[model samples]
Every structure is written in C-alpha cells, then in structure tokens.
Target: MSNLKQELKENIIELLNLEEFSVEDINDNDALFGDGLGLDSIDALELMVMLDKDYGIKLTDPKEGKEIFQSIAVLAEYIEKNRTK
Candidate 1:
C-alpha cells in the first residue's frame, strides 16, 4: 500500500477507537459507516472533527459531510481532494 492509504487506515482506526480492527483488518474500500462497520451519525461527527484536526478541513455542514463520508474509499478521496495539509 502507498503511504496515503496506510496513513488513512491508521488514522481512521485511531480516531474512531476501532479497538477490534488492526490495520490489516481495515480494507481500503471498507464500508466505514452504516451496516459495514456499524458506525453511526456520531461517529461521522467524530470523523469530521478528525478531518479538521488532522487535515485542516472543516465540514461546517453535516449534510455536506453525508456525501463526503459514505465509505472509506469516498472519505479518502474527499480528503485527498480537500485536505489543506
């Protein structure tokens, strides 16, 4: 895996407190929300905070976040496109 993919996986696991998943358990295209990982709205909010904290991207609108955070693949693409740092 490239550094970006690895970093994203590690960050997601750490930021979301996914204690049951090691780095390898998190596939690059894993569904991070809804039925896949069982993450809920609150987890999405936490992940938004993580984006702001770690990537310098602030998602002020929760609705906007819904489109951006559909899954790990989508989230990574959004971050890659929007992250300031």
Candidate 2:
C-alpha cells in the first residue's frame, strides 16, 4: 500500500506536471481530484488510462472508477486486488 501511494505521488507529479510538489507533499487520504489537486473529469480519464496501461487494470466503466478511485488508498487497494501485472 505504501509503495502504491509512493508510486501514485510520483506518477501524479509527473503526469500532472505539478512542478511544485514532492511525494511527501501528498497525503494518502488527500483527494486526487476536485479541490485537493484540482483534477477534473479529463484528468480522471487520463488516470484511468494510466491504470490500464501501467497496472493492467482496465476500467470498463467510468462509474465503477468513482468508488475505486475516491482516494489514493482506494485506488491502491483496487489495483492490488485487480492488477494483472
């Protein structure tokens, strides 16, 4: 779980081009979308693709992602359980 959160921090920094944040800046419970990081629906789509490409967890329905991606904790748990790789 820690490793997944760490990786998420790295990926978010890179993927979002967040030039100001370090991995330590992100809290595990911090919301990845909305006011927390200012991410939107498009960002969610990008993240969904990222999860599919990097983790091999294809999210066929975006609605399913809502619960699975509420926060980094949930995302990591979902990935750990469903990841093909």
Candidate 3:
C-alpha cells in the first residue's frame, strides 16, 4: 500500500501545517513523534481525526493510538487491515 503511505504522508504534512517537511523527507519507518518527525500530542489528535474521517476507522484508546502511530509503515498496515473506506 505504497500509495496509501504516500497519501498519509501528504495528508499529515497538510493537516499539521508542517511546512518544514515534505513527503520525500519522511521515511516509511520513521517515528512520527518525539524525535523522528517531532510531532506532539496535538498532531496525534489530528491524525486520529484523519483516520476516522478518511478511513472510517475510529480509535477509542490512547494506548492503541500510540502503537498505531509509531511509524508510517505501521500505520499503513493497520489501515490496510482495518479501514472501512
């Protein structure tokens, strides 16, 4: 699901207003928080919204969100398996 991963990268940059980053700047295995991409709790919330709105996947647990948001690769796999849209 390379296309899905790419779309996710694009959407994240746009959604978070991360103007300093580009799609090519984010690797599939890079962490989305703390150090790799340097995202914070606010960005995570936005991503959760994007997941629900774009993939029809609603997350209810913060712990689960932590696991899914580990990296673009992991997120893409989770979406491929669980996405309803």
Best by the TM-score measure: 3
**Residue 35 alpha-carbon offset, candidate 1, angstroms:** 1.6
Worst 10 residues of 3 by lDDT: 34-43
Which tens-of-lDDT digit does each residue in 41-71 have in candidate 1? 8889888888899989999998899888776
TM-score rank order: 3, 2, 1
lDDT, candidates in the order shown: 0.81, 0.84, 0.97
Let me know the TM-score candidate 2 reaches against the reference structure.
0.90
Weakest lDDT window of 10 consecutive positions for candidate 1: 1-10
What is the per-residue lDDT of model 2 for residues 44-78, given as tens digits with 9 covering 90 to 100? 88888889889998898979987776788888888
* Candidate 3: tens digits of C-alpha lDDT, residues 6-26: 999999999999999999999
**Evaluation by lDDT, superior candidate among 1 and 2:** 2
Error of 1 at 40 (Å): 1.3
RMSD values for the candidates in order, in angstroms, are 1.7, 1.1, 0.5
Per-candidate clashes, comma-separated: 0, 0, 0
Off by over 4 Å in 3: none
- The TM-score values for the models, in the order shown, are 0.85, 0.90, 0.98
lDDT of 3 at 24: 98
